[model samples]
Structures are given as C-alpha cells and as structure tokens.
Target: MQTESNGKRKRPKKKGSRFMRNAKGFAKQGIFGRGTHIDDDQFSYFINILDAMKAGFEDVEDRVNMANNVFEQTVDKEIHLSSNQIVSKAIESLIGFVDDAQLERFFGKFGDNLRPMCSDRFASHVLQKMLEIAFLRGLGQAAAQEQSEADAPGPAKRAKPDAAQVEEQYNLETDFSDKHREQCRNFVLRISKFMLNNLEDFVWDSCATHIMRSAILCLVGIHVPKIAFEKGGAELAKHRKLYTVPEEWHEVMKEFPQRLELWPQFVDFPYQEHSSALLGVICLSLSVVDKSMLKHFGKKILTQSLLKPNEDNGDDDDEKKESKIEIDDDNDDQGNNEKQDDNEKTEKPNSEPAVLLPKVFHYQCAVILLETLLSVAGAKLLTQLYAMLFSGRVAHLSQQQQTNFAVQRLLQHIKEVSDFESVFTELQPQTEQLLKMGYTGVVSALSGACLRLGAKQAQMIAALQSALHVTGDKEKSKLFFNCLVKLKPHELLAGDQSGFVHLHGSLIAQHILQFNKPIFLVNCILELPAEQLSQIFNTPNGSHIVDAFLQSKYIGEKSRERLIRQLDGFYVDLAITRHGSRVLDQCFKAAQEAQKLHIAKELSNKANMLKGSPFGRLIYTKYRLDTYKLSASQWQASLGQQQQKEESVGQTNKRPAKTATELFKDILTQ
Candidate 1:
C-alpha cells in the first residue's frame, strides 16, 4: 500500500526550479548552451535583465546584485568556467540597451564603489565592461545622427556641412558626445586620483600599480587618438573617420599638464620601475595637447626645469652623511659582543632619506618629452629643442652622459622630421665643437640624415673631407667610417672634386671596404675610371681596397671582366709589390675559369721576373703547379695503357713512367 501511494504522488517543484536547471546547464556548457544550439528563451531572459538595468527599473540594482551573486556561485561550482566568460556575455547583452543616460546615472550613484573594484582582477574587468558599453552606445548614437544628417537633403535644399561642422561630426562619430566624453574622462581620472590619493597603499602592491598604469594608458589612447593623426595624417583619414579635438575636451586636456607638473615628485622613485609608465603618459599627453600649450607648458616647465643643474646638491650631501651614520651603526654591531645601552650609543633613525630629483633623471625625462613634443608639435618645437641643445645651458648640468644621450636622441628625432640639408646647415658651424666635446654619435647621425635626404654629392664629399680630419682617435675614425659606409659616398668619392683632393680616396675606400661589403660598394669600386683605379692600386694602403674588391663575392661578372681588363698591363708590376701581390693572388682565385686561364697565361710569361721577388715567387709557383697538375694526370692514364699492352704480351714492363714530382721538375726546367 505504501509503494502504491508513493507511485501515485507527483514530486513537488523547487523554488525557481526552471532557472536553477538552466543555470546548471549553462554552467556545464557555454552561454549559448551545448554546441551551436542557442536557448533563445533563456537568452531573452538574460537580455531582459540588461534592458531593466539600462532602463533603471525600480529593482534593477537589487536584481543585478542578485545576478552577480548567482554568477559567482555558478563560476565556483563549475571550476572550468572563467569569470570573464560571464562578464563578456553580460556585456554583450547590455550593449544594445546601454546609453549615455544610463551610464551617467550608473556612475553618479556607484562611482565610489567602482574605484575599490579596480584593484580586484575580476571586478576591474566588469568596470572595463561598463566603460566599453558606454563607449559603444555613444558610437551608435553618433553613427545614427550622422546617417540622418547625410540623408537629410541635397545642397540646393540645405547648406552643406562646413569644415567646422564636419570636424565636429567627426569628433562625435569617433569619440562620442561631449557629455559622454566627460563621463569617460572622469571615470579614468577618478581611478588615477584614487591611486594617487592612496599612494602608500598601492605603491608597493603590484596588482594595484598595474591597474593604475593600465588605466592611465587607456586614458592616453582614448583621449589622445589624435596622436595617431599626427603620424599618419591624411593617409590615415581616408579609411576611417579622423579625430578632432572638441572644445568640450579642453577640460580633459587640462588634466595632462597638471599631471606633468607632478613628474618632479616621482623622480626619487625607482626610475627603472616607474620611468616607462611615466614617460608613456607624458608622451601621449604631448601628442594630444595643442601646439601652443605644448610649447609653453612643455618647454617652460618640463624642458627648462630639467635642463637646469640640480640646485639641491646640498640635500644629496646630507643623505650621504646619513648613509655614513647607518654604516657606522652596522660596524658597531660587529665590533662589540656586549649590547650597548641605548643612551650610550646613539641610535640612528631607520627612515629613508628625502629623495631629491637626480640631475640625470631630469635630463632623461626632458629628452623624452622633447622628442614627443617634436613629433607632434612640428617645426616650432623642433627649433626650440635644437636651440636648447646647442645653447650650452646643458653643459652646466652635473652629468655629461645624460646630456650626450639627450643630444643623440634629439638629433635622431630631427633627422626623421626635418630636411637634412637644412639641419646640416644649421649644425655645420658647431660640428667642430660637437666633435671636440666627443659627441661622435651626433656627427654620425647627422651624416646619415644628410645622406638619406639625398644631399648633393659635393656637399657630402666636403663633409666627409672635414670629418676625416679627426682620424687620430680610432673610435672616432670608426664612427666616421660607419657613417661613410652607410652613406655609400663612393659616388662622391669617384667624382673629380678639389675636396676629395685633400682627402685620400684610397684611404677612404680602404676604410669603407673594411667595414662595409655591400654590392653597391663593389660596383662603385669597379666603376672607377682607370686613372683613379690605378692611383688607388699604386698606393700601399690603397692596394688593400683592390684586394677587398677582388675577394668580395658580390663582385658582378661584368665587373670582374672590367676589373681583369684594368689589370691587363699591371699584373707584373702588382705581382712584384708586397701588398699588390696579395691582390694579384685574389684576382686569380676570384676570376672566372676563362679569366683565370688568361691571367695564368699572362703571369706565366713573366715567371722569371716574378720568381725573382719574394711575394711574386709564391704566385709563380702556384701558376706552375696548376698548369702541370692536369698534364701529370693525363701522363698517368697513358702510362697505364702502355703497361696493359705489355701485360697482354706476357712480358714484364721494365720502363718506369714519370712520377708527378719528376713531371713538375721537367715542366719548370722547360
């Protein structure tokens, strides 16, 4: 009877049985359920909640909090699932529902709650989702508005959009409405402020510091989208809408300069730890700020302040004294076994010394900021930076290494943006001064810039002539050599100019050959007129260049033929000289089969004259060995045939065939 009653009764349904069942299923599979099949009803329910959230339904906050709790539980139960998976799905569902009004209201009430979540890895994702949703909604509204305006009427019926209107529309389409823009700006600013306000709490915490840095970078990319514009210009504009700075964004731009002013305070921090993050923010800021503002604020505050020598050397001295006291305390511990009374031994304080900005740190930051300014602000800031570099003000700084590095970086930036000829003209008078100061990098960079700019042959030749005067130092000469090699100044060197008259073409050619082996250099050497080639081939140092040319694998077939022709009458003369004989040997080795045979025949004619000289004797012996080796092989083949004939006749072959040694002696005697 009990079994029959149990069978008759139906099981009672649990509270939210359907939701629980679906949630369990979703936890097992993905958001769309198993495979490609989607549970539309369940998806619609999820989207409905997003709609409610966007509409600010009376119980929306409570519902969202409850949903979040359920999501966390599901994630906990299903160890395979990630928090990001749930957050991504939630964000996707809310994308269509989220609008500017919703974001403003959400932030207004919950902004304070958002700051603490930035430090939480999972919670930061949700905050980022909120920002992304707000950005997408703003974009949708802008695109819709643009389409409406575009479809409005013809120019006859309505005035076409002016440049200002077009620019404004572009800003809206790209960045969003001014109100939404402000909210996004404030969102990032608030996070930055939170980190700054709670500096001690976040400074040593890696996670918090990373969040802060990421937030800053995000703000930089968003607020300074125009930075890309400065680089790509109209070429970038053709494919996508360009960003224009709006009047409303002026408030956002103001935050950067204020932050830049705080740079000095951070100088005492571990530069290796914080410099990249700080420089990234500053560079991005410089790229977006107005040129006038950049010139005024960046030049006056950042550059000028950094360029000046540190006035607080006295503070560094005090810190050294404090360090000495700490060392003495450490020594006291090792010297005595008995513990001293606190009164007897003065206890030094354990506090860190106050960090004054180092001169090197300021110089590094100044150089980086100046480079950023030059890239974005164009010629105006470039002129200012150049003036500052040459003004001798930096010489007064404590560290020359920092100043030199700054100059090198500045010159590199200038090379990229300005005409090299103009830069050279401006810097030419100071070239000697720069060299005297041991700034060879500047000279090298300047030479490269000039060459890249396609500076005229005469001018480059003159520069090379002037630069060669500082050949006393091996390192300086190497720097000049590298510059000349990269410049491929062979064309200028080949030309008949008075400037190169003072310069030894062969010496320069030898230097170029040693450091660079480009095909063009080989071609240049081969293409030299007979007079010049002969001149270079005659000199002891110059013959090495000829040897380099012959030995290079890049020497073309036609160039080889031309080179062989040039050596037509000079082989005997070259074979007698100490350096020239090496070149003659290389010529024989590198020449094609036909050229090699011709050269061997020509040298064999002068074997007597060549054999008299020490270097030439080696060439003479090589020639004789090569010619006789094939003959000796043929003689052995013939001698074996004769011996076979004798064996067939059943007779012992008593006549011995000539050995290779005997054959070589016979050829030499003949």
Candidate 2:
C-alpha cells in the first residue's frame, strides 16, 4: 500500500511540474528581482512564455495568473523592481493576445500598474510602451471596422447607434479605443490626469519627483500639438508643430480642453519650492492652449493683485486719523482720555498680517504671465501689458527692486521676441523717475537691456548720458561710470572734440581711473589730441587719472612713452603740488630708460630746490630710492663710511698748526 501511494504522488507532481517551476522561478528571480541588470537567458525565457500564451498554449490561464501576480507584487513595492524591461516585453506580447472582449479589462489592469510606476525611470518606459501599443491596436481596429462597413451590403443595413449609446460605448472601452486618434487622445489624457493628480506628491517627495517631472514633460510633449490643433484648427498645425497629431479627430478634442483647464492653476501656484519645474509645465501647456485664453485670465488676476493697494496706502489713512485725533484733543476737556483713545486706534494688534506673499513673487508671476502672453497672444498683448506696467496704475504697488526685476524680465522677452527698439523708446520717458528714486540698479538693468536690444551705440550712450546728468550723488556717479565702462562708450568719451571733457570731464577722469579696463581708457587718453590731453593732465582730478594710468599694470610701452612725453615740461611744476606730485612719481616709475634718464637729470639739477619744498622732496626721494635701487638706510650708511674715510685721510696728513690769532694777541699784549 505504501509503494502504491508513493507511485501515485510522484505521477501527480510530475504532470505539470516543469512549466510550473519555470513560471515560479521567473516571477521570483527575473520579475521581482532587486537589480535591473537582467541576463539574456532569463529575459528570453519570459518572452518565450508570453509568446506561447499568445499562440494559445494549453497553460495560457496559468501564465496569465502568473503575470497578474508579478504585476501586483511589483506595484506593492514603494521602489521599482528590476523587471521593467521584462514586464514591458511581457505586456507587449500579451497585447497581441488581447481581443476586443478583453481589451478594456487588460488596459484597466495595465493602467493600474502604470500609475504607481510613472515616477520610476525604467518603469515609465514600460508605461510609454503600453500607450504606443494601445494606440496602434486602436488604429488597426478602427480601420478594419471602417473597411467592413464599406464592403457590407446596403439592402439590410443595420440601424446606427444613437449618440447616447455611442457615448456609453466610448466610456466602456475608454481605457482602450476603437477610434484611431481618439484612442491616442484617451491614452494621453489618462496619463495627464494621473500626472496632475499626483503632481503635488511628486513635487514634495524626494524619491522620484525628477523622473515624474520628466515623464510629465514627455507626455505633454506628445499631446500638446493635438491640443493646439483642437483650438487652432488645421491652419495652426502647419507652422512648426513639435508633435504629430491627427487632424481628423473631433470627439477627443471635446473633452481634452476641459481636462487641460487645470493648467493655469499649476502656472499660478503660489509656492516657489519647485518653481522651475512648474514653469516648464506652464510653458508646455501654453504651447497647446490658446494664448488668448491664458492672457485673458492672467490680465484679470494681475490687475487685481498688482494694482491692489499696499500697506503704504494704509499708513496714509492712519496719518489722516491721527490729525483728526489731534483736533479732537485740542477741542475736548478730557485730553488724557482722548489721547488714550488715539493711542489705541493707532496701535494695531500683534497678529501677523493676513497677506504674507512676497512682492518679488507677485512681480515674477507678472513676468511669467507676460511671457506666456507674448508667446501665445502675439506682440499686441505684450505691448498692452508693457503699457500697463509703466502706466502708473500699478506702479505704486511694486517696490523699486520689484519694478526693476520685472522690467528686466520683460525686456529680456522683448529682446528675444519683438522689436526692442520700440519697447526701449517707450521706456526712455521713465528714466527720470528711475533716477529720482536713486534706483541705480534699475539704471544698470536698463543699460544692460538696451545693450541686448541691439540698440544703436549712439542711443545707448545717450541713455547713459541722460542718467549721468541727473545724478550728482557720488555713489550714483560711480554706478553710471560703471555702466559707461561696461558699455564701452568709448566714442562718447574719446577724441579731441568730445564734449565729455567740457561737460563732466573731472568726473569722467575720476571714473576712468577707477574703471576695470583702465588700459582701454588710458589708450583713449593717449590718442586724445594734445590740447585735451594737456587739459586733462593739468586738472587735479585729471592728474589722478594720469597717476592711475601710469601706475596700472595694463599700461603698455607705447602708452607709457606717450604719457612720459606729455609730461616732459610739466614734471617740475607737477612735482611742486600735492596731487601732481603723485602723478609725477608714478610717471617716474613708468617712464622708459631714456625717459627715466631725462627725468633723473632734470631732478638732479633741481635737487636743492626740490629739498626745500615738501611735495618736491617726496618726488626727489622716491626717484632716488627707485631709480638708484637703494634704500634710505643703505645710502646713509655709505655716506657715514665716506665721511669716516675722509676723516682718517685728513688725520693721516695732519700737522701741528700755529694759530695766527694767538700770535697777534701776544703782539698786542707786548
């Protein structure tokens, strides 16, 4: 009986043991494995099983059950399994096996698995494959049905389904499709919805947000042209379409617009935590949606927020109330009581302000919205927006810095997309207000913006000159000089006939000395006509410029030679004054060998005169130390040694000398 029972058990276990063991091993080692590096043998084994199932093998049900188990296990894990390629291959093969009757069920399961895996890089690849396959299958089926209807006899035509029934059927197989392009639309919309719903999750979660954002961008990239087409029609499709979308489909277009309406919310999300990623989504959406729609919405919101009164306005009201209280105090007998009431009215509670949004954020939103408008609504809307920004309607709402930032961003867009000359010309009138506010930053930004606008060099120089003429503040003067130097307005400052010397010559000279490219300015000075160069060197501030140029490492041999020649006759006179002495000393160091010899000869002749003057003595001593390459102590030591040697020689030759005075006195006394 024991042998009989053993034989029976062995036969039962051996019946389907080979297939079952292979399936189990694939599910464990290949499908739910830890690493992504799958060997070819394991991958082939899984593909072969899928192919067998498609070929209607007897154990098809068993393989299907195993696939379901594999998908479930993969989805339950928070992190991705190494089975993306293996699972994608399995699904690709399985898609061929699925018929119309089971299409919806298959896709329902597929989408469920895809939702959790969208954030995974490799898993997202599998999801993309699912979408492409579904699209192709739907297209093939639609073509077949159309051909069948065309070939069928017309005598006994079947009644067409009503719109309600058609809608129901669409809903039933929404995950899959019978219409070619509608199916593609459904696939993209499904993924978009999934991405939108989980957008906050992906943004906040550090684990997989990068892959999620990439996937979102990819999905939007594929579907944007379709959305653009639905709104823009066929004419809009011909111009630089990034994606290929079908022109025939109108049914999916009906639902797609409503689905994408959530885009503006993402665009206007107040949190700046993941702003760059969010801006990408906004830009992508704007590519498809009608720019007029976003513009209309943006203008309304921007007007409300940007034109809203700020705390400064509230301060004005408080001041009015305080003045009224002072009048009451003067008229009433209860002065102390009235004062207490006034104090209570003026002192606000320590509660936090209701609105905490940063002014910069509001400005950034305005800029991004304006850019979106420009890209979508054309240049007309951009002009209107620009006018609004500078029209003084919302000007008080923005801080100076905020206004500067907004202007920079707006100008950047204009420079890229439109004729910047018109925009810059419009902004020219505001230069006075920008300067009056001491907003040198805005001035610099404007200068930079004008440069980018490809404005004429003369126009840019004129703008900078206007900015300089209005500001007497030392700090603003420095800022304007920096702007001029950066713009390299050499034509405006150089040449013998240039009015810079007559207008702001000392200021220009001082700035040129402090300029980053002192060599460029020095060369400009060297090329100046003899009269202008003389005038520059003669002024106190201009002498400083010459001093700075002579001391600069950037000064070349030719420039030094020219400068030394210019200073030939002025050296003695310059060395006698305080500021000029500094210039003369620097020139002494910078002068060439021939020039140095000339200067040294001149100074030696006037050594006694130089020693008597304070500023002259500084030039003489510096020349001696630098030209002779001797320190003061070394020269003094040498003098002492010479004196000692002379004394020794005198003593060696010494003899007892008779005093003539003593002999004369002795004669007088006798």
Candidate 3:
C-alpha cells in the first residue's frame, strides 16, 4: 500500500507497478497507434499540440497558396514564355510533378507515382483528373497568352518577365495544370527502353509503361484540335489559340527536333501495342504543331529514332559486349559461364549505360527546325536559313536524300492545308523552289496541280521537263511523258504559234530521240492528222530521219511490226503519192536488209489493197511510174542476199547470231 502519495492509489505495490507499465505501454502505443483510443490526459495533450501545429501549417499553406496563385497569374501574364516553358509546364503539371502534398494526398496512392495507390478505383479517377486538368490548362494558358499578346504591345515592351521568372511562374502552373504529361511521356519511354534493353525482371506491366502509353494517346489527340481550322471559319482562331508559330518560339522549337526519336525507340519493338499508340500520338503532335516546327524536327527525330546500331569500333571488348543478346541457351556449361559472367557484371557495375539517342535527337531537332523555316516563311527564307544552318554539321546526310525529304514534307504540308492553293499562289517563288527540289513525286504533284489550275502550256511543259531531269524512275518518266502528251495536243498545239511549235517540236523530238527503249511518241505521231504527220515526217531530211528510225533499237522486230501497222493505218487514211513513195522507198530498204518478209509482205499487201482505191490513184498519179520495181522475185533475191551477207559476217567474225531486236540494238548503239 505504498502508492497513496497523491491520494490516487492505495493498491498493492506489485499490482500498481504492473498497471503502470501497462499504462506506459498504452501511452506509447497512442503515439504510434493503429487507430486505438488514448487516455483523457493524452487526448487533451494531443489536441493542444495538434492545434498549434495546425496553425503553423495553415500559415505556411496560406503563404504557399499565395505564391502558387501569384506564380500562375504572372506566368499567364508573361506572353513571351518560351516553348520549353509552356511544354515543360504542361508536361510537368500534367504528371503532377510540381504539386504539394495536397495532390499527393488525393492522388499519390493512385497517381503514376513509384507505387500506385492501394485502390484501383481511386487511381483511375485521379489519373483522369490529372489528364483533364493538364489538357485544359495547357490549352487555356496558350489561349490566354495569345489574347493578352493581342491586347498588349510588342513582347519586349509588354512586360519584363525574364526567362527565369517565366520558367518559375509558369513551370508550376502548367506542371500542376498538365499533371505531368511530359513526365508521363518520358517515363513510358524510359521504361520501354529499359525493358527492351534489359529483359530479366523487367516486366511489361510496369506502371511507368501504362502511364506513358496513356499520355502518348493523349498526344495523338493533340492534332484533332487543329482540324477545326481546315475549313476556314474559326480556322485561324483554332491555329492561333492552339498551335502558334511565334518568332520567339524558334529557340523553344529547337529543343524538340529530336523528340520523335523517343517515340521510335519503343515504336519498333515486337509487342509494342502500347508503345505504338504512343508513337502515333507523337506523329499526331508533329503533324499538328506549327508547320515550321514540324518541318524543322520531323526528319531529325525520325532518323535518329530509326537509325540502327553500328559496329565499327576498334575495341574487341566493346564489340563483344555489344554483341550480347537475350540469352536463350539451356546447356549446363554455357549457363554456368553465362551466370558467372552475369555475376561478375553485377559485381562490377557498368560504367555507363548505352545512349539511345546521342546525336539523333540533335539531328531531328535541326531538321524540324529547318522544316519550320520552310513552312511559315516560304522557301526563299527557308533556303537562306537552311544555308546558314546547313554549313558544317549537316554533312552526315546526303544532299539528295535531304532534298528528297524536304520536298516530301513540303508536299505533305500542301496536302494537309485546305487553303494551300491560295497560299501557293501568294508564294509562287516558294512553289518554284519546291519544284526545283527535283523530287519526282513533289514535281509531279505540283505539275498536276498547275495543269488543273489552267496554267499556261509553256509552264506545264517547263515544269514537266524539270521533273524529268531529276528523276531516274521509268514509271515516273512515263507518267510525265503521258501527261505531256495529254496536255500538248489540246493545250499547246496552237498556242502563241512560235512557242507552241518550238515547244512541242523540241519535246516531241527529244522524246523520240531520248527514249531508245520504245518510241511511244511515234504512236502519238501516227494518231495525228495526215497533214500533221506529213509536216512531221516529210521534212527536208525525211530520208535521213527514216534512216535514223531504221537504226533505232525502238524500231526492232517488235516495234517494227507495230510501226508497220501504224504505217499501214496511216497509208489507209492517206491518198498515197510520190512523197509517200519516197517514204516507202526508205522503209523498203530497211525491211529488205533485215529480211523482214512479214513486214515486206504487209507492205506489198497494203500496196495491193490500195491498187484500185483512192490511195492507188494518188500513188500512181504522183509517181507517174510505168511499172512497180518491187517484185516477188526481187524481194526473194534481196532476202537471199541478206542471208548470204549474214553468213559471211558470221564466218569472218565467228560471232554469235542475234535476234532481229538484238541486231537492231547493236546497230542503233553503234
């Protein structure tokens, strides 16, 4: 009974001691309790301390709240914020990169944090909110800045929001707003890259993987907003609010040229359903963003991301290390060796991880930047800027490939824009440069457009000629030729007479001479009226021209029969005469020499067919010949002579006999 000092207890000493220890333990548990009750005194003390702490926390929260508000407001006011600022803010906030414990309290468990929340239902809601807020905020801020800029004077004079201040203010605002969209993009990419690079324990179901994929899909929808402007009303408004090409943003755009490479790292993987969706988003973003920016970065990002690994290092160790792949072997000996190696490697950490991008990002960024210069300002300006940037570093790419890509991208833009026609008209010089790009598709599309626009025949011809010179593809050449043929007779035949005649004359002759494969022009020529044919085939040097045709590989066995048919068709239409006789004389010699009896027979049959017809009368009257010198006997004798001459040549040279077509090719080239 020794515990009666405070008149609280008169119990036994052992009982009191045991109870006190229990009480002490219970009090400690209250400090670290799992939802258990505390005694009255403990409760009172806790309430007092909690009140004081809450007051202090409230003051800090109030100040932080004020700072956050001011930062957001100032960032909204600063119209001159760089694209990095805008993008960084949008991405950082979208992923909730900058939020305080408040956001964490609500979403930390469920958000794309290191470990997601315990409850799935809560996570989905939190993620959805983060995406919505980020998207809305990014769009809103962009719109608000544009509106403010419209109301204000020049940016420099508008406000003194330096880079740091702009970054600090908008960084958190957009970060909070976007909820860490960029981080999502980055994380998904990082996870995918890592998983692909390191297979073991790198499960596909990583949370970072899902977040990145979702974020990428969100990006894919980025361009959908721009589609509203495709048809005029609120067109500029849409572009203005959502996708702008502010001169000040040039530097910001520079950073993103290689952004596409990040996409390809995951895009090419075997089971990259998630990664592919993300890549699609990236492509959509590239398509929707400022055209100039797209032009600048599209290729750079595309190339860097798509480039394969090269192995030319002199070090065998590096080469051997690079050669390593996912181990599939099960042999005991190999497994032992592999495990040992792995353990050793684990013991000795790699000095550095392989860089996925290296110069790829820089290249893509440069290209996209160059593309932007070409898009907004026009080719002249872009070319000038291109010249400036392309001096030293661009030596990696071939000139031809670069030009091809540039023209291709330009055409893509032309296809993309609804008002491309109007824009093209306003920028003729630029169009001309695009044509000068010498890409087959680019030139062809432009030429077709010109034809559709009712551009002058001279222009069309010039454009086609330009296309033909640059391209080596036979299909494209044929297309250009056919297009010219279609346009010439209708649009060009009777033009300002000199230009028309000279143009067609030069082009037709060039085609006849240039294409030794087969003279499609001859078929076209035969289709012309007799008068036109006469004008073309009955020139001062008609005989010489005939000799040229005979020497051509194009007029060999296959084409010769066709030409004979064409000639027959032409003769049937014509009232044959002395001039026709002269032409026939030239063709007769080649047929006789080649021993083309079929062609000879056809010629004679045609002659006989015309013997009593209108052509017969014209022929007889014009020739005034008493008799026909070509006879069956003479034709047979000429054939014999050609056979003898061929035998003699074979005996003298011991050369292999050739087909009629082969002989024609030999003679024409010789």
lDDT of candidate model 1 versus the reference: 0.46
RMSD of each: 28.2, 32.4, 33.0
How do all models score by TM-score? Answer: 0.35, 0.33, 0.23
lDDT of 1 at 265: 47
Candidate 2: worst 10 consecutive residues by lDDT? 1-10
Query: What is the C-alpha lDDT profile of model 3 across 150-194, one tens digit per residue?
Result: 333454344464222233334324434244434433333333243
Answer with 2 or 3, whichever has the higher lDDT: 2
Count of clashes, each model: 0, 0, 35
For residues 1-670, could you state the per-residue lDDT of candidate 2 as single tens digits? 0011211112122223354345457666545322465455655565565555445434435544555544443343312332344444454334333434343444455576664565554555445544544444434322221112223334423456422223223323434533544544576557645655666565544323443433343343322111100122233223211222343232233233234334555333322434433443444343443445445544543454333433433565556545654555375666666656546754865522222232223544444444344443334545665555543322222234434545554554453324456555655655545544444344444445554454543454445556545144543343343233222233333332322222123433343444444553464555555554554455554566666566555456687788788767567766777666767767766676567667766666667777778888877775563433344455445545765887899778554553433322222111
Worst 10 residues of 1 by lDDT: 1-10
TM-score between candidate 2 and the true structure: 0.33
Worst 10 contiguous positions by lDDT, candidate 3: 223-232
Judge candidate 3 against the unseen true structure and give its global Cα lDDT, from 0 to 1: 0.36
